[model samples]
Target: MSHSIAPATISSPKDLIAYKVDNAEPVEFTSSKGYEERRIHSEIYKRHPHIHAVVHSHSEAVVPYAISVAPLRACYHMAGFLGADGAAVFDIAKHRDPAQGADMLVRNEQTGAALAKTFDNSNRVTLMRGHGFTVVADSIEVAVMWAIYTQKNAAIQTTAATLQSTYGGTGSDMPLSYLSSEESSVAREMTKRTVERPWQLWVREVESCGLYVNTA
Candidate 1:
């Protein structure tokens, strides 16, 4: 399916840059490979107009988990972002080329389409091994929230694993009952507000950093 970039309603590239800088991470939109990054971002943004931004990153823990033979299952309630059972893992192994590096596209439009197919009618997050994680939402805030929280969940699971050997806790197990009704209600409300705000703060952030430019 053809996907278009959604117009900025609240946030701007500046805002996203600032958020990344503050978090000590490089902004994907401003990197040398920004074009491909933007393409992926735009595709998701167009398909989900209600969302403000789509963020992807290579987190330390997630990177190892992605390359592992075993899938990273949601082991705690805080990882509800992965969805009730956990999200699907996309194998980008074939996309990796020693000459081209790990940036090879394992699957093109077809891959993206198939990867997204699993999330149909659901708010599931996906793990693109050797690539990163993709979180789709109705707004930038929600996207950012998921990006941050998902990393946290991974860290928690890792820590739990270390503790499990000695303490003997459940392994990579996330019970749906762990998701409280109140948290779910709040998530819905937050999503609504994020869609309304767009990337207002993100825009200001980019401007303040003196990185605002009309690349188009």
Candidate 2:
């Protein structure tokens, strides 16, 4: 199906911000930085019209794993959402700028595009070490689901590590190929449900709260 955002009635950034706060995660925007977020949102929307929402968050496990030299693997079924190979990690250490906030830790537009390109032929999911994550979906519900499931996978891995250390059990050994199949199925279902039905609800909420301004 062709993925595209319909012409929305909401205009001002405040309305968008309000909508985002009420429906999804609470977004922080000072008057000074608020315009910047709005601009970014607009740019993202313009570039990826099909993307209904863009989520920026810090997944605890993913953060440490990114900083470590070893690559982070998907240890649980839920992590399949990141694809069977697991999400590719882009080394953003060179892109770091202390002046920018947590998000800027990934550095400039080049870094962002590089990270996005990692998922070029796939669905939404990318990790930035010490920065956070960026998940793009056709709707907020799908985006939120990806965020939650990824965290669940991380938590499971953490628990598995504990068990392996204490009880001498083997850690998660699921291969990427197996995980990829599961991830595709879950992503399909989420896309259908979130995009077909609840997306309207999300749009309305974001419009009302003005948080939609952060569309980039």
Candidate 3:
């Protein structure tokens, strides 16, 4: 989806930008990038019926791992949506074009379609090589946590890698031994059972902080 410009300063409902998506092609709103946003968002929605929301954010912590060989592992249960296996990085230049113009941005529908297809039902997160990351979820709340978890996970992974290096460790290292196939399956199943618990907890926290504006 097209992210809000200067979203952190958004204090009122009027500060947000909303768009009506359709099955047809997307038109550019302010500039050429607007068409790119329209097609990508609409195409993703069409492809994944379960996905009600998408988040595109840049994480400084995740930038290195995205551009480098380091992979995003499923190390944290809080970000269980990353799946038990691990994460994948979508590189437009590598995957789409090796010689010509394969910019990191999702500037076309084909690129957007390719990126959207990268995520199956098992995983909802992907690192855009050289750019940033995108998080897909059933709702905005879940998507928000997914984004946070992904950034935190990247930070933790980097720390773990550094510590291992400090300890004279090398090759296929992580904070802890990654989850086995069996363990990963069980972890995902447990997340399905406990999905709403964290949402409720977050609601209480937001209300307590007086940041819970009833937009609905």
Q: Write the per-residue lDDT of candidate 1 for residues 1-216, one digit (tens) a residue.
A: 111133232243433332231222243434322223443444444455455556666677676667675455555544555644455676755433445445545333434444545346665577777767777765556777667667887787667666665576555573223344455445545544654354567556766764444543
| Order of quality (lDDT) | 3, 2, 1
If both were scored by lDDT, which would come out higher, candidate 2 or candidate 3?
Answer: 3
Residues 41-128, candidate 2, lDDT per residue (tens digit)?
3334445667777766666766765666544445654455666555656566554355565554433454444554555565567766
Query: Which candidate should be chosen as best, given TM-score against the real structure?
Result: 3
| Clash totals, every prediction | 13, 20, 0
Best by lDDT: 3
- Greater lDDT among 1 and 3 belongs to 3
lDDT of each: 0.54, 0.54, 0.68
List candidate 2 stretches off by more than 4 Å. 1-32, 35-48, 69-78, 95-108, 169-216
Query: Model 3, range 1-216, lDDT digits (tens) per residue?
Result: 333444443456544335555543423343322334454566577788788878887789888877887667767666556655667788887455544365566755567788888776656888887888888877787777778778998888788778888885675543455566566567655665676787788778866765435443
Mark the regions of model 1 whose C-alpha exceeds 4 Å error after superposition: 1-34, 45-52, 69-78, 93-102, 105-108, 169-216
